[model samples]
Target: MSERETWASRAGFILAAVGSAVGLGNIWQFPFKTAQFGGASFLIVYLVAALGIGLPAILAEFIIGRKANLNTIDAFEKLGHKNWRIVGALGLFTGFWILSYYSVVGGWVLRYLGGSVTGAYFGAPAEYFGQISAGMDALVLHAVFMALVVGIVAAGIEDGIEKATKLMVPSIVVILGALAVFAFTLPGASAGYAYFLSPDFDALAANFTDIVPFAVGQAFFSLSIGMGAMITYASYIDGDQSLFGDGITIVFLNSFVGVLAGLVVLPLLFAQGIDPNTSGAGAVFISVAGAFGSLPAGQLIGVVFFGVVLIAALSSAISLLEVVVSWVIDNYDVSRPQVAVTLGGIIFLLGVPSAIDTAWLGWFDTLAYKFFLPVGVLGILIFVAWVYGAPAIDELMKGSGLGDGVGITWLWLARTLVIVAVVVTLALGLQTLFLGANPAIIPPL
Candidate 1:
């Protein structure tokens, strides 16, 4: 066996992790969710859930990965709890499941990027979206998008994934910041800001049940929690880096990007007289495309906006693909390139149904968000809090600049509040799934 690859630098690892967290979950889904829920009310709940539950859960996975220095499933077994490998398996499966449909959306971003260049979608934004959203065009674009992901993963971590994200993440931030500045100058921008920033305590209190689940789901999804991507990334750490510090940084950057996305998306929609409250999976593409079409310098702005989204999509896709690829290379004798191509092809084929028809995509996404993600999160919390026990804290404390006191607090929180919160969220998600409840309340992350 050969030595495992490590991140080229701390900055590289941080960028890759942030790239994974700040994908379509932020740019595409966050805006619509804010519109569908009570805007700032939803934002407030999401921030709480992210810090309260998402951060600790992320540290748990980081501990498991860095301690074992192996792939997700092997990490557990290497830690002397072979039975707990099931949790890692769930995470691996969830990542794979998500990417299948997720690549389909990535395809849409790529198509829109090109359409923006030619002003193709500007004439009739909705019709254009309808034409390209499914059928052969979508399937072909899905393959193209997956190919880009495979090529990068095959190049090895430091040279490919790290290098790509170092550029992509920064570009996402700079472009988004500029777009937000532009959005603020629009005439009706105040209404969008009001919708996103102004809180309605009454609605939040009354619709707590309906709102909280989606907020929790958004936190998990946006942070790339409950997927094995973070675990896989952590396995590449070369030293006793501060896992706590890194986790905090990732959460803050990810949350900032999500909020920044809202700043650009909502204002643009309101400026063009498009309803920001439009719901469903197509909300971002259809509504935002219409807004871009009607704006001055619309085509140029559309090109830049969709280009940023395409970069975000690819960055996240690389992490999801890496989770599966890392596991295979750890266990099998195959080379990284071979594994990437074979698995990428299989994933592409799996996504075909979704590419052909978006209803299938919705089903795949719903299953992942509602069932798979929460279960993966719950399993990791149990393992870290119970099975790994005290040593989990010991691993988290290396170079973390903290004493035993903080570690114990994190452990107990994981054992009690985090676990219970996950259980409640999972129960609510399951109820919505099985009882044919209103899905708009628990939109797919």
Candidate 2:
């Protein structure tokens, strides 16, 4: 086999990693959850979870990938015990599972973007969403989105993934920033700002227990933890750049973009005097898009917003496809382009049911977000805490530049605190999924 590929530059790797994290979760889901769970309160808990649990978990994956200098499955096989390879395999599966439905949503974003330009859904957002969500149109759109993803991955890492992210990430930020400024200029925009920035202390106090799990789950999902994206991305690190700093940078960028997204969404909704208590699926389609129909230059604004979604969605989809492709190249003799086409084809086929059936799409989203993701996270935590043992600490200290004492601090937290929290989150997720009880607590996207 040829030599393993490495990132062309540290900035490219960071941008690609940040792009993976700042996806639909940041733009579509985070704002909804914040609107649902007392905005500032959810923000506070989410920040804690991101820095406390999410960052450590991300660093652990980085340690594993860089220390072993291998792809996901072999990274585990090479670094830890034999059976631990399943953790990596599970991550690969999680990436495949998520991208299946994720591409469907990407297709939806494209449809919405086109609709914005043509005023197709201008006066009838709900009907348009329902009509396009299924049938042959949805299938065709899904395939088109998957092809875009495959085309990027097939070009190889430096030329493809890194270059694409370098463009997309900056564009996403600039567009969202401009939209937020424009959104605030709308009448009654202060109400939205107040709703997002001001905390409901009493509501937060009452719902503290229920909110923690959602916050942690969102953090995990936003950072692309528990899945192989970080592990696979980290394996391409070319030099002794600090993983600790890069991990922190990635987390901060993800959280900032999520907050920036909220600034755009909440203001737009409040400007139309729409109640923010709608279901997540309807928040963007019914509330935001419906509001857009009534405003001046709404079509132009809608085009920009949905365009942002398209860029964000494609950025994330590339990472998901790369995860599976990286593993194939590591273990098999297949070329990158062939693997991209083959796996992308299967993933596109898998998404057909989701495109045809809304219920299937919902179920897949729940299954991956609630069950598979947390389980994958738990496996990594276990591997880092117990199996990897002393070598894990050694790996952490190298790039971190933190002494043994700080490494132990991280180790103990991961072994005890994070593990217990993940277990509880997993159990609550299962409970909510099986019983129809906890509808208020949203899972991470």
> Per-residue error at 85 for model 1, in Å?
0.6
lDDT of 1 by residue, 207-320 (tens): 777677788888888888888999999999999999999999999999999999999999888888888777667888999999988888999999999999999998999999
Residue 199's C-alpha lDDT in candidate 2? 81
- Taking all chains together, the TM-score of candidate 2 against the true structure is 0.95
Residues 1-445 of candidate 2 have per-residue lDDT tens digits of 5577888999999999999999987897788878777888888888888888888889888888888888778898787477899999999898898899889888888899999998888878889888998778889999999999999999999999999999999999999999999998999999999988888889889987557666777888788987799999999997778887888899999999999999999988999988876654436766778878988898998999999989998888999999999988987888999999999999999898888876677677767767888898899989988778778787777756777897888889999998888898888777767675545244323
Q: Least accurate stretch of 10 residues (summed lDDT) in model 2?
A: 436-445
Q: Using Cα atoms with residue i matched to residue i, what is each candidate's TM-score against the true structure?
A: 0.97, 0.95
What TM-score number comes out for model 1?
A: 0.97
Show where candidate 1 strays beyond 4 Å: 438-445
lDDT for position 439 in model 1: 53
Q: Which RMSD does model 1 reach against the true structure?
A: 2.1
